[model samples]
Target: MKQILKNSPPTRGIDHLAFVTDDLPATMGFYTKVLQMKLVHVRRVPFEMDRGQPPYDNLRHYFFDMGHDQLLAFFEYPQGLDKQNRDLPGGMQHVAFYVPPEKFDDLIENVKAQNVNVIGPVALGGRFWSAYFYDPNGIRLELATTRLSTPGGIVESVYQSEEEARKELETLFDDPETVDYWLSQMPLKHQ
Candidate 1:
C-alpha cells in the first residue's frame, strides 16, 4: 500500500468525462434542458480516422458544465457509435455525480419529470445513497450523496500501518456481523 501510494501520481478531481455522440442536437438538448447543465463551450477540430486515411475536417467537441468546475464533454463524429465495442464486459460503465443529501430527492423527481426512469436511492453499505438512470445517449449515470459517516472515515486508522491495514482489509469480508451493521444503517425510503 505504501509503495503503491508513493508511486501514484497526484490528481485533482476529474476535469471532464468525454463521450461520443451521433446526434449532437439531442445530446445538447438533453444535457442543457433536462439535466440543467450549462453548455459552456463548443469547438471543431480536425480528426484523423486512421494513419493512412484523410483527416476528417469537422469533428465537433462540446462541453457541458457538471458543476464544481467539472465538465461533461461530447465529440460529434460520423459513425462514432458504430465504432464502439458495445459487447465488452468492462469498458466505461457509468459516471456518478455527487449531490447534497437534502437535494437528492428533488433531483430524482426532476429527472423523472423529464420522463427518464430512475432506479434507486439505494444505500451503498450505509456510507452513501445512489440513484441510477440512463442519459439520452444511453450512458448510465448515477447521482450519489455521502452519508454523515463516509467509508473514508476509517481510512486513517486503517492505513496507519501497512501490514495491519492489509490484514484488516483482507479479512473484512469474513465478518458478517460488521457487514450487517452497515446494512442496518441504510435509510428506509418509505419511512
Candidate 2:
C-alpha cells in the first residue's frame, strides 16, 4: 500500500519560491515570528547590466527555510519598489503552503492570535481545505491541508471521478470533444 507521493512531479518540486519585499526586517520578523520559519541565508544580488537583476548593486536577498527541502526567498530593494495590485494581470494571486492535517487548526489559531485576519479553512473540493491570510508585504498566503485515508495519499485524496471532471471542464470548452481531449491529459489517479 502506498502512503503518499507515489508519483513524483516531473520537476520534483520547487527549489525555492521568491518574492520582493520592501522591509527586510519586518518581513523576516513576520515569517519567523508568525510562521516560525527560520532565516537560512542572506545574499547580495549584484547589479549586472541587463542581467535581469533587480537594477541595484548588493541588494538584499534573504532566504527562509520553508521545509521539504524548499526555500521561500525574498529580495529587498533599496527604497523599495511600490506595491502593485495583486489582481493585475501579471501579479501573483496567492501562494499556499502545505500544512499537515493535524497542524492545520493550531496554525490557524496562532495566525489569528498574531492579529492577522484570516479567511477560512474553506473547503475546496474533495479533501482540500485552506485558510487564507496575508503577510505583512500583502502577499496573499494560504495554509492548505487535506484529510487522507486512501493509500494513494494526496493524489488519491484529490482524485475526481471522470464524469465529474468532464462536467466541470465542459464549461471552459466549446465542444465536448475538446473537453474530452483535455480530460485525457489529466494525471491518472493511481489505485
Candidate 3:
C-alpha cells in the first residue's frame, strides 16, 4: 500500500555518451562513413592528466549525432588508448542506439557494405528488433527498433493508480539472488 510520488523529476532523454579513442580520424570515419551518424562538432580542449602522469598539451573532443537529440562523443588524447587502463575491463561494454523501424533494415545493409560483420536483425521476444556490429575502435554497437505500442507493450499490466504502481515496485527488490547477481557484475577496481 505504498503510494507513487506524483511529482516525478523532470528529465528529457540522454544528452550524450562519451568514450576515449586512440585515433580520432578513424573513429570519426567509422561513425560518419559507416554508421551514417553525422559528425556534429569538434573542439580542442586542454588535456587533464591523471595522477602521477605529466600534463599533455591538448586533446580533441568530437561528437556525432545519434538522432533524437542524443549524441555519441569521443576524446582523443596524445597517448591515445594507452591513456585508458588496458589491464582492467572497466569501461563500457557496449552501446545500443535506437533506430526507427523503417530505417533499420537499410542501416544493417550499410554496415555490411563497410565490410563489418552484422550479427542480427533479431527479435527480442517480439518486443523489438536489433542488429549488432563493431566499430573501427572495436566497440560493440547495436541498433534497435521497438515493436511495442505507446504504453505497456512489454509490461504485464498498466497500473491505473499511483498506489498500484508503488505497491508493485515495493516488492521488486525482494529477490536477494537477483540483487546479488547485478552487484557481482560490477567491475572490480583491483581485478
Question: What is each predicted model's overall lDDT from 0 to 1?
Answer: 0.71, 0.83, 0.70
Clashing pairs in 1: none
Off by over 4 Å in 3: 1-8, 48-56, 79-90, 148-191
Best by lDDT: 2
For candidate 2, the per-residue lDDT at 76 reads 89
lDDT string for model 3 (39-89, tens) is: 999987775657532345566789999888889988775543344433368
- TM-score of every model? 0.69, 0.86, 0.67
**Model 1, residue 8: C-alpha shift (Å):** 8.8
lDDT (tens digit, per residue) of candidate 1 on 78-102:
7644544444875677888878777
Worst 10 residues of 3 by lDDT: 151-160
Where does candidate 1 stray beyond 4 Å? 6-9, 48-56, 79-90, 149-191
Q: Considering lDDT, which of the candidate structures 1 and 3 is the better prediction for this target? A: 1
TM-score order of candidates, top first: 2, 1, 3
Residue pairs clashing, model 2: none
Least lDDT summed over 10 consecutive residues: which range in candidate 2? 1-10
Whole-model lDDT for model 3 versus the true structure? 0.70
